[model samples]
Target: MGHDLDVLAARFGRHYPRWLLALLIISTMTMVLSSTSINVALPAIMQDFAIGRPLAQWLVTGVLAAMTSGLLLSSWAQARFGPRATLLTSFGLFLVTSLVAPFVTSIWALIAIRIVQGLCAGIAQPLSMVLIFRTYPGEGRGMALGLFGLGAMMAPALGPTLAGFLVDHFGWRAVFWLPAPVCILSLVGGALLLPTLRSLTPPRLDVPGFILLNLALFGILAALAEAQRFGWLHDATLLTGAVGLLGLAAFLWRCTHHSAPLLPLRLWRNASFRHTSWVSMVLGVSLFGVTYLVPLYVQTVEGYSASDAGLLLLPTGLVLGVAVFAGGWLSDKLAARWLLVGGLGLLTLSTAGQALMGTGASFWAICAWASLGRLGIGGIMPGVSTAAVQDLPAEELAPATGTISFMRQLGGALGINLLTFFIEWRHVAEGASAAGDAQAFVQSFWLLTALFALALWPAWLLRSKR
Candidate 1:
């Protein structure tokens, strides 16, 4: 009866394909916008805080720690609460968070709000994928995922540039305000257009699992992020990291054996799931690094201002949007394996090209590499997403989607941090000095290239869609 209600809602109301696509894009944009805006404003944040400088900025580190924690809860929330409620709640919190973020008076306060934003982000993203599976049927389903990717993936690509402009001309506060309406609009629009699909056999919230999982993540990531700055075995960070790892191991043990694990282990049984998870993990480390490094390349190395770097990256978002659409259409027609392999291959090449870049590399060369990488990323993301969750039964779709998406997010976070740490280590080893210098950035780019290459082996295991 409820399924019939959902059908009627989807059919008689605002119909799910194009309208829901718009909603999905808008919804994801709000989160993407928030994330990008924060990155652009980190400098202003330091100035406002009048705090000490660390090699890795606390603004980003704090957000990552928070987002990682949030990922632990997202799947459980979607399974227990229903995707529609989860999505609505996430966007609603996001809007509120974005509106008030600019007014934060202290660095810790800012970090706190961002941590909350990450939690909200966790709910919004995984739920977006789950909805497409539920609302979009047949080929339209593939199209829906593509459109969702366009908004989610492409937004961050363009956001840094836009945020740079807002921060330079306006204050950092403007960054928070710009996305306020977008979030609000997404909330209102989603409420109206998206069908009310409630959870089936809603599971009770697993509070103990949530606590254990988060403790593990917090300890592990904090240790990893801080260890590069602090020593591994000498510092408290090492202790924190060890605790987190132990917690993670325990969490896994529970997941594999528990009747109602936070994330059911059976989902990993799909070949696509296993492949995409590993590949996405590796790509996460590389792609996240590249996104951060790319802007730094143009601004610090090329001597362009933040605004210029952002504008240079603008074309990337356009290309990426186009790629997502094209990739999604092709995902349905072609087996994802070759597409996956080809996309990752191109991405690896682009990373290598970026790594080889010297201080004097031409502007056009940089732009060309960015475009190529975007194209490859466009092709592979849909394939990763579509293939990863393909074999799951209807009931498990949300968790499957959430778990894969979570891993990707997790990968990207770890990748960016790992790259940053590796580059910093290289710089210190070579006695390189300061931010905004091309010499300091060169080795880091190469390291990331190696990381991208490392990501390719997972795609080898992917079988052609038969």
Candidate 2:
């Protein structure tokens, strides 16, 4: 069987790597679109479920949390089950989950399904990077990584526009149905196109490490989710935060001590990986923070409809997609440190501009600011990803990619929750007028600007050579 699979891979290898990359890109776009496109539909869902902003926010939080947990297992799954089987399984689950999503009646049920959907997505995300790096030559890998970044970045870019249209015309349930066709196509293509290569000796799954990591993630998110209502100093909130911190500490210790750990802590010994990981976390915060806030602000404060708000983001998304491809191409020739500095610098400016928006801010103004921020993000993504793994040996690639992906998602999960809390707090403090809501959002953007600024120093410290 192994020999047969090797022959199959050789046969496919003759066709060039582009075909395989196409399939992987489509699969990635489908899953990522599922994650971000839903934000445009949140207002509609809030109305239907009769829930507040905080509860509605869980739809995203649940998915991010699940995705974060799922990423930790991706490298292991690929090592144990082979990349081909793992991707096929994830795509199948994604298809099934999308089919079931439209029928969910309760908010909790929807969150549960979103979690499962996220898990499926998590399984596929890291493999997208691993497979691409494995297939493409080192000379061209930067361009390949950029193309992959385009798809990954474009999903969130285009997701809101698509979801907005669906939500406006067919309602929120339609948003859930969007990924169906893409999933079907990916599953079929993956079955035939994915390389079948398994680990020689399957690694042991770190059950205890997995448990501690999840505990930390869940506890931190839960604490933040409830902090708006419970008060920060409340016993429950403090207890949950403490538990999460303790779990994180224990997990770190285990990774250092265990012979076969869930995450290899030694990966951090490389300065490039360490700096890139920090930038990745801040990028995650900035990326998701803007994505979440923009639609909500436009809808609630500016009185734009779901479709209108979604449309507002279309131009920014389009610009970001193009910029990502260009950035990836540039990564091959330029030093990553300069790219990171420029990108983060622009991101900070764009975010600061967003903080200056008032209730009377025009649609074009919003579009301009968002496009600028996304352009910065596109530039940062490919460079950061390429830099993170450039120094690692072949064997460390899987874990390094998985670990980096995990950090970004972890930052996303926490960032969104933190932004939500800030929004809620500011809304209460400023009072509940349209202008006041806009002010609260402005305050949140300022906070994001600070984060973006903080990320720049580390990004500047990245290796100066390609």
**lDDT score of residue 396 within candidate 1:** 78
lDDT (CA) per prediction: 0.70, 0.84
In candidate 2, residue 390 scores what lDDT?
A: 79
Candidate 2 lDDT, 255-326, residue by residue in tens? 999998887889999998999999988877766768888998889878888898988888987898888777
Q: Write the per-residue lDDT of candidate 1 for residues 1-466, one digit (tens) a residue.
A: 3333366465556554567777777867767656655565655565677753243344554555556656666656766766667777887777787788778787677667777787787666766666677666576775576567667777777778788898778887887777778777887876666555556776676676777787786676667666766777756787888888888888888788777777667877887788888877765554455666777556555666667666767887788889878887788788777777878888878877876777777767887887888888877877787678766678977577667666776776666666566666666766666543455577776666676666677776777763
Candidate 1, position 24, lDDT: 79
**TM-score of predicted model 2?**
0.92
Q: Which ten residues in a row have the lowest lDDT in candidate 1?
A: 52-61
lDDT of candidate model 2 versus the reference: 0.84
